[model samples]
Target: MTIDMNTLDKAILNRIQTRFPLTSRPFATIADELGSTEKEVLTRVSRLKDAGIIRRIGGNFVPGKVGFVSTLCAAQVPEEKLDLFARTVNTFPGVTHNYLRENAFNVWFTFISPSMTIIRDNLAAIAEKTGVRRILNLPATHVFKIKAKFDL
Candidate 1:
């Protein structure tokens, strides 16, 4: 779906994509930066979210530094059970992101936990609950670069 965003929306997206304010009222900070009222900024953000332009708004942390373990998991779920499988995976708080792709391993997600044992146990429970035959748990061995910024 395509959204015809206005200049304000574009500005908001560009500004908030990477460096969001870490203040008590972050939206108010954003409003100040954009020369908009806090209510206006909040309303625009709400509209963007309603339009699916914003999938999520949250914090991202370095797993290793924070005493947390993160992994990329994939499962080849049958088409008939894809919805159920995806929903099952979403129940876990550690399952941060889940997606359906066009490959043998059609389901993919990122899971973060305090330890590898917790992640493994959660995956095992997920497999049991979803009745998926196989789930590939791929931990990041090395990262050349990682960036999550989109230019508007």
Candidate 2:
């Protein structure tokens, strides 16, 4: 059965938001924090993943510190042109996540680059290959927190 999102699901997600401990008894630490048994916590996390409520459990990283620049780009593509546009956008290096959002600029993606100039060129190449007349490059001036464990 597909699991519906609920309170226990939220707790499982909350536990994952923080780093998973590295110790001989890490599960005990997590259990203490979540008011759950170690086995229960482990089972619930696995169940959520199986049911597609939790996609992954991991830490987010900083790109510049790791010698790369990361940013989000939202591109405006013509509706009749999704396939052609998606093919071009998907070809760029450093594109990790790409999704279609229902808005003016629908093709939203995150990208990483070795330098800032490469970001400009990458967007340009996408535009050229897709025959886009206008493209918006909004490299993140300030990244924001978009992740939170919802109190389902």
Candidate 3:
């Protein structure tokens, strides 16, 4: 699963992991910083994304400041219904991250919504729909380190 990346690819990955210009033409800005053309930057980024080097490109907002609350949810899904349960959970707009683990509570995800009520309702609906009885709702108790930077 080793992907051979060129200098530009490595530079793009490393640079973007820390700072991406907040501009209308971000790729153009990156191109300027990298001594390359906008087209070249865009094309290389597209190739990187297509090759699965980049999972996503978006903004991260502070939940409380932006009128949002987030929670971590876990469900003990049976092996037979894992696929259906995951697909159903993914339908919610607020469900940002979902994962399958090798544990008693095998399914986990993070969700964000305008209020705790909405978050609870969504979790209840998911539980009822999927016939999953035991769901652990873990809300953030404190703020800690939350950053992902790679020097690739």
lDDT of 1 by residue, 25-124 (tens): 9999998998999999999888999998998888888888898888999999999999999999999988887999999999999998998898899999
* Model 2 lDDT, full chain set: 0.77
Candidate 2 lDDT over 86-136, as tens digits, reads 777777878776779999988888888898799988888888788875667
Model 3: per-residue Cα lDDT over 1-152, one tens digit each = 34678999899888777677999999899989999999998888888888878867877777877988888899999999899899999999888869999999999998888988998999899988999888899986664657978787
Which prediction has more favorable TM-score, 2 or 3?
3
- As for candidate 1, its clashing pairs are none
TM-score of 2: 0.59
Best-to-worst lDDT order: 1, 3, 2
lDDT of each: 0.89, 0.77, 0.86
Quote each prediction's TM-score: 0.91, 0.59, 0.84
**TM-score: the better of candidates 1 and 2:** 1
For candidate 2, give the lDDT of residue 122. Answer: 86
Error of 3 at 90 (Å): 2.6
